[model samples]
Target: MAFCPICNGFEEIKIACSSCGNALMDNGRIMDYYDDYSPYMPIDQMKMEDGYPADYENRECPHLLKCAVCGMNVVRLIKE
Candidate 1:
């Protein structure tokens, strides 16, 4: 099975906000924000319906990162 380092807490992403240059906070997987029940579903299953057709096939985990200073939101794809 494919696994995500960030999601599993095995690693961390350090990215600067393009607008404010501040640190971006990881807000977990983007799939979780789809609905209330999305967080409770299986990871691979959710990836299939996460709007990105290649996420499941590529085993990539999409994470939502936000900048508190500029309120900038970004979607980063992490290879699993």
Candidate 2:
């Protein structure tokens, strides 16, 4: 099975904020924000209903990136 390098702690992704040109922080998987128990659910199961049809099929993990300076939020799809 494919796995995310960032999620599995194999690497780090640094993103710059589009609005402020500042650093963006990795908040975690996008599904973790879906509900109270989302974080505890299986990763593959969450990806199936994560609103992105291609993520599960392509082995991609969607992460929530937030810019601390500009408060800008973005969804980054990381290849697994």
Candidate 3:
């Protein structure tokens, strides 16, 4: 699940930068950065693919959120 900087919960939450208090935008799925790849790949397939790493998970997609004003991270959706 995604979360706002303020800790609000939702599947697609809005967020803001903690330092600058600027609105954060959804930059799209983190997998978009991987050229010739799909986020929808099965877990087993993802593990076998090169460059994806062995620990890839849904919550660790840092590229999914970005601060629109400062270009910093604002969303706190990663599950600990």
List TM-score per model, in order. Answer: 0.95, 0.95, 0.46
RMSD vs true structure, all candidates: 0.7, 0.7, 6.3
lDDT of 2 by residue, 5-79 (tens): 998899997978999999999998999999999999999999999999999989999999999887999999999
User: Arrange candidates by lDDT, highest first: which order?
Assistant: 1, 2, 3
Cα lDDT tens digits, model 1, 8-76, are 999999999999899999999999999999999999889888888899888899999999998999999
Point out the worst 10-residue segment of candidate 3 by lDDT.
1-10
Give one clash count per candidate, in the order shown. 0, 0, 0
Tens digit of lDDT per residue, candidate 3, span 3-60? 3232233455556677688777776545445566565665335434524453245434
Clash count, predicted structure 1: 0
lDDT of candidate 3 at residue 43, scale 0 to 100: 33
Off by over 4 Å in 2: none
Number of clashing residue pairs, candidate 2: 0
Evaluate residue 14 in candidate 2 and report its C-alpha lDDT on the 0 to 100 scale.
90
